[model samples]
Target: MVVHALHIRPSRPGAWLLGLLALLLMLPAKTPAVEGVEGELRGAHRWSGEVLLSGPVLLSEGASLEIAAGTRVRALAPESSLRVQGVLRVLGTAQAPVVFATPQGWHGLLFERPELPQILRHARFSGAAAAIHAQAAQLVLEAVVFEGCDLALKALREARLEIQGGRFEGNRVGVDLELKSFAEIRDVHFVDNAEAALLATGGCRLNISDCLFQGNGKALSLLQKISGTIHANRFVGNDGALVATRLGAGLDVSGNFFEGNRVALASNTFSQPLVVDNRFVKNETAIASDQFSTGEFRHNLFQGNQSALINTRRADPLVTRNVFERNQVAIFCDFASYPQVRENNFFGNQMAVKLGTYQSAAGARPPGAQREAQAGANGPGPAPTFAEERPLQDFVDVSANWWGADTDLLASLDEQGNSPIFFDRRDEAEVKSQDAFAAGGPIDWVRFRPWLIAPVADAGPR
Candidate 1:
């Protein structure tokens, strides 16, 4: 009986193996995917491929997980989180950033251990409730990209966060720091956030510098005893650039540039910030302080703004050595606001000092007007005791200032004809409030006399 035998010809030794490898190469490559990852990572792990998470994951204590560059982590379930209780080193390169994405909203990364000091660099997170949420944890995030998140990063309960060279765009709030936390955010770009780009409250300390904040609702808000320095930042096209609430002892904002914002710097509710050497250009109101706040605005440059400085609601601040050029109104005061304007240079301003509503020329006079009693006093009197009533303020002091190279034109003031330089009670008499409880009378009066012949040498930003 003859059996059919199949004969195959081989070209050379290992030729079949080469053919098999070629066939394998022709097939599609599937990246190794870890599906439905949850529960505890028991031991040290290094993930270099795609990982899909269905629920929450807990990195066990003492276990370390290192995600390599180009790793893609997708969350299938909503609100899923990676809780890092141990060391998690997600080291990604700029060319191959580790990605964490969710179509729905997820929790992103949560760090709870303070001693572990987890770090994530060159990572991208999107569609998260919070991209990084830490409580008393020490975290360092560098070159990260956060987008479409409700809140990009949050530090609570004494958490320490150091973020550098990241981009936070299209988020509700870029950073929320509270509960005595500490953060140093540097060289970051915060753009198109819905709410405040950076907010620090509850006695937190922040050191933010060299950042760019643009097209946001509010660039930065510091509330309730926030201390530290915000230096050399650029704020452009925001509704409000910086707002400080309450008082911080050593809050310094210096060397910043604000352009085209609605309000550049606002001090409210007794906030006393040391704002120095900043440049405000083309803003609606460069500096607006109100609600009994007292701040030191020194050596700032205000140019082409609608109102260079607006003081209202009993805000009493020291305005000195500032340069106001080509502004609509250099200083606008109303509602019992009292800003001591001295040593400033005002050039080409439409109205050097404007008094709106409740205003009068009670203190400011014509070229030959007479002075009043106690006019030499540069500041308001000390607050009366709790039992005694405070005395009424009769005049507002805006003396010792330089009003352009045409300083002598101020001497050619005509009461009936109007000077066209200042708008005060001379233009309209003080409007007394009809409401008995309202203590509004001539709070809008401004006195600009003892004027300087030429511009001050120490004016404008240092």
Candidate 2:
């Protein structure tokens, strides 16, 4: 009965324990004999029942280690770990849950404490590569259960965590706040993560609330200096929900809901991103503004989306007071898209602003727009890789909103005095760009009058 140690029980009494329980019932129900441990474990220590970890085990710096509840702690191969720099406590509960497996894989849980104070409630980390790897640590994970991990918490440098009510499943990355790390993830439940179920970059400082992101491929991916406060999360069926590409300041994605996501809330190459009171439903695109990202999309609620805001290339957005309902095309405006759409509530939309053609401006030119264009002294082609010295607002600002229909047929407009809710470029010819318009010119007008004789009644979702 000796696998790694067999936990020393030399007593040979009662007929050698009934002939070693009939030779442990004919050997192999997947043999398991714990109690091994290795290297430095200074002052205090206490583990329960089975414990194997046969290689790396340094719990030094004024040492202390306590793990009880239902301790399993296996790992006798794959470079075993558990190197906490000082104290470590894994007081599991909730029906005795404390398992730290190693099914042919190991090396995890290396918390090099700086501010000390560690914790680990109701633990159950599996096959690690990083099931809990902090550096300047200060953990406090409760109700934990990261399964099949590759990285279920890899906080580096200024590490500080407080993850509550956890359950990250099939992790590839369920919490990887780097550099200036600081987390606050609450009521978590991220499931089926392959890439990002919370992957903040460098200057991290998150505070995600009431989380639930399901079937994830993205569910929150903030780059560079990601700042915080993503409240009331729920994102379902994700392929992408909540992207914040080039961040650097205090972020905020208020009261979220995002259903059936394909892209609910993206904001590439950042410049500003506030995105208020969210709710996007049945998404295929709710709020994407790529390349040159935009700010403040106030009081949201786009329902049944097919578009609900797509803005491409040099994307411009200040869309306020939202609530576009029954959308099929609420706002798509592609290349160099402009969007200052104001005070909203365009109900039952089938097409409340669509325009995209203009030949897609050579694939919407983003990603540094193929630089190396040296030809000008204001002459010939090339030269401008990045311009926009401020001015460019050539229309596409759907003024005061409230176009649900029939108010004398939207005050009778059409013929480019637009109010047929626009699809623009004078409704076809592939939406303008014959060198930017000619033949009876003057058309990119979606600047819907100072309209809104009713229904802005405090826009959507508060």
Candidate 3:
């Protein structure tokens, strides 16, 4: 109390405290809140149970929707989906791959929009009807494993699929192409499927390069009017390597190594396909065609096959410039169908060419006997002793120089040691004469005929 009516100011400490309280009142209150969208198990907010999403859950730019490794997602009944109408980029490493499996069978990722973007790598999807169904969208998947699914990648109706370095195993069908879709499958492995490893239907175009197809029921099957280019691929240990039917056109199969398959190329009637530049080793039949189907067999190497290089019922193929080596019987033309044989190397086979009663007796008759018989019947009136038909036109210009066990024939002639003996007929002996087919050297025996069989037979280029 001031007796003289004097009012005193507050202390400096009191003023400072009042000012600090006023500053605290002006500041906004802070609370603990969720940071990102729900259902993601990372960051502050983690969701459990089925995540029923009505709208697309977009992640932050440059951020990935990462499902933790060894984590399983169980979708709710009648609502089993994680539909991404936008982009769903999953980045999984080899050791820790993200899994999108359900408690029961369901759909994993349904990409609906045409412009939806998705990138899935090193991920696993199982127990789903379709692991990944991309419709009219662009999908880039690599190092992914798909199992227990009907179809691994169902790219439908103008969708594009570029799959590389992935494994599609234990699925009904590995990759199903439909309705003008385009797919480029490279560096992939497909095995142990009930149906075909890669099935292309609905006029699609599949370019399979540098891939391995092994232990599958049917490796690659093409139906409808689809066109496929299978190049630089290895098909081994499959039931059937390739089966194309129903008027499919523009199938360019080249530079692919086919080994140990049951049937290499099986084409039905009305399907004219091109099979060129492929190596067929130890296959049951390299090519088998039937009834009005035309096959172009060119620049392909056929070795160690059990049956004919080309076994056809009625199709007259355009066979040109192919090498047939060590096969059992090359070119078995059955049912009166004759392939147009031209410029092809027929050597090292058990039987180079077998006409199978298709060629006429006159055409099959031996060359030397025909001339002798005409002269004998016209003037001498005595028939020749040997009358056997030899293959002539079928082997237009076949060189036995590289024939099996005949490589020595060519070397002897080059050395100029001795004039090799060529037998005109099978019932001949080795005689030292210049007129024979030599083991190695070039000699025209048609002009000279000394001891007919001995000189021609023993004089082979050697």
Number of the predicted model whose lDDT against the real structure is largest: 1
Quote the lDDT for 66 in model 2. 94
**Best model per TM-score:** 1
For candidate 2, lDDT tens digit of each residue in 105-204?
5777788864577999998887677777898898999999888777878887888999899689877888887889899988889988888888878888
lDDT of 1 at 168: 93
Model 3: per-residue Cα lDDT at residue 288: 76
TM-score of 1: 0.87
Cα lDDT tens digits for candidate 1, 269-291:
88899999999999999999887
Model 3, 380-448: lDDT tens digits are 566654423333222112232223343344344542233222211121212223322112111111111
Off by over 4 Å in 1: 1-31, 359-388, 414-418, 432-434, 439-444
Whole-model lDDT values for every prediction:
0.83, 0.77, 0.62
Error of 2 at 207 (Å): 24
Which pairs clash in model 1? 360-425, 361-425
